[model samples]
Target: MKTFCKFLLFITLITLYQCKEEKKTTIIKKKKLDTETSSVPEKKIVKAWDSLNRHNTEAFLTEFGKQNPETKVLIKTDFGNIKLRLYKDTPIHRANFIFLTKIKYFNTTVFYRVAKNFVIQGGNSDEMYTQKERNKYGNYLLKPEFRKNRRHKYGALAAAREWKRNPNKLSSPFEFYMVQKKSGAYHLDNEHTVFGEVISGFRTLEKISKVRVGVDEWPVDDVKMTIEILD
Candidate 1:
């Protein structure tokens, strides 16, 4: 009987020991899983198109700085090097262009739209994957910072907007049109944001402006643009 009692005690102790080990293993596994989850932070995902409506000027300034903090850019166009001095006054617009240029955002992109003796527009690509590439970077729009001092003069690089639909809402974040004619885009002075000007490349711009185009003024042969920062 004593032997039987001793055997039962031994079995009980072994069972308890096994249970305790299993409980410890389970706790360890849960803790490991928790630690792994905590280590990886959830990234704030934002679409490029959605970024346009942001009302925060500081946020716009921050992203602009991330993309283009420089004060000058050299557009290596087919015509020649169009050295441009970004407006120090228009900080948001200037910074944004610098960012796009530094990253070669306009490389290989065709001057999609051109108006003879008027404006030359670039930043869209004929390549099928250009839109996808743009998506990967950002989708945001710039709130128009139209100043009276910034006129739509010849050689002025101005942001393009969906003006027909966006009455009084001047916001064109990605695209820009250069004033090619000497008469100046006076009609556009109060309408669009005139951000930068051709400090040294007005002549090169004139040459590109003369390039022949189709119905939409899209240059028959692509006019590729590469950019470099000076200051």
Candidate 2:
């Protein structure tokens, strides 16, 4: 009877050991699955952006800080690095910029428009490649996302337009202008989309804004622009 009881105890011990091992395996599998699931959203985001690389404006819009806070952008120009703070209120414009920077879209574009004592414009150029890329990825019109709190003030970074045909609608998806003077082009309140401001690069902007320009306010020498995110 003692031997029988010992055999029974041994059987119980072995069963408990097997159960413990099974539980450990289950925990390990669960941890791995959680890690993988967390990474899926990130991979999906990149995949979505890549899918929209062709010409989806709304898809491009989703790539920016929707629920996340606003971000700063550093425009490394031929003259100097001009830092700009993007608007948290304007998600579409902010995201558009973030997406553009990630794709190195501004690497070859120039600060083509420079108006002394007024504003400095950038993003579109005579670069055949730029024109072709613009033709490829996006067009030249956004229904001017004008917010009341934001206006065309000094140091305001606003979008540029082609002509006065659409006074209420904004034009130029790529081209943007930076205000340099204090008078403040308030007249442009309803016309252009002001999406950002100069947080640290006003001095650099002043230098670029004062560069020699032709009759069209285009810089005599091309001021090349490259964009990156520091934080």
Candidate 3:
């Protein structure tokens, strides 16, 4: 009877040990399962929206402005670098420039229209890449954000607009210009939206304005430029 009891006790210990080993194995399997599950990439819900039109432009820019809080940009040119500061009050235009810079849109563009002593217009290029980029982004117009105080002072940054048939004076989102006139082109105060001003690099602006241009004011040698946001 004592021998039988000892055998039974041994059997009981063996069963308990097997159960403990099974529990450890189960735990290992669960951990491996969890790791495999975590390794699998989850489906991301991304917005594939197109064409920032009048309906969505304002809302898009408003959100974009909040995301990109950068107020300064550096325009890199063959001539020299021009530092600029975007105004917070002109949120829409400021956001637009910041967005364009972040996307590397200005890298493929050039100082297309340089009116000597007046303004140096840029962000348009002869390369098809420029048009392709514009198409990719959107063919949109910016509503006039004409602040009475934002005059076209020398080194002022403003948007290009069509004055021929545009009664509302909506600004062209793709192109922009900087006033080079020392006296200030105040006549364009209300017509064009002066969204920013050159903080430094007036010399660069001067050099760019002096570049020889054709009858249409397009530079003889394309004034290629790349604009980057400054922290």
TM-score of 3: 0.78
Looking at candidate 2, the ten consecutive residues that score lowest on lDDT are: 40-49
Judging by TM-score, tell me the better candidate of 1 and 3: 3
Per-model CA lDDT versus the true structure: 0.77, 0.78, 0.90
Best by lDDT: 3
**Sort by lDDT, best first: what order?**
3, 2, 1
Clashes per candidate, residues 3 or more apart or on different chains: 10, 0, 0
State how far residue 215 of model 2 sits from its true place (Å).
Answer: 1.6
Instruction: Rank all candidate structures by their TM-score, best first, as comma-separated numbers.
Output: 3, 1, 2
Q: Write the per-residue lDDT of candidate 3 for residues 130-226, one digit (tens) a residue.
A: 8987877567889999998899999899999999999999999989999999999999889999999999999999998898999999999988989
Q: Which stretches of candidate 1 lie above 4 Å from their native place?
A: 1-60, 63-68
Enumerate residue pairs that collide in model 3.
Answer: none
lDDT measured at residue 176 in model 3 versus the true structure, 0 to 100:
96
lDDT for each residue of candidate 1 in 39-156, tens digit (9 for 90 to 100): 6667999855335334554475667676555777788876888877777777787777776665566775767887978898888886755675566445556667788888988898
| Ten-residue stretch with the least lDDT total in model 1 | 49-58
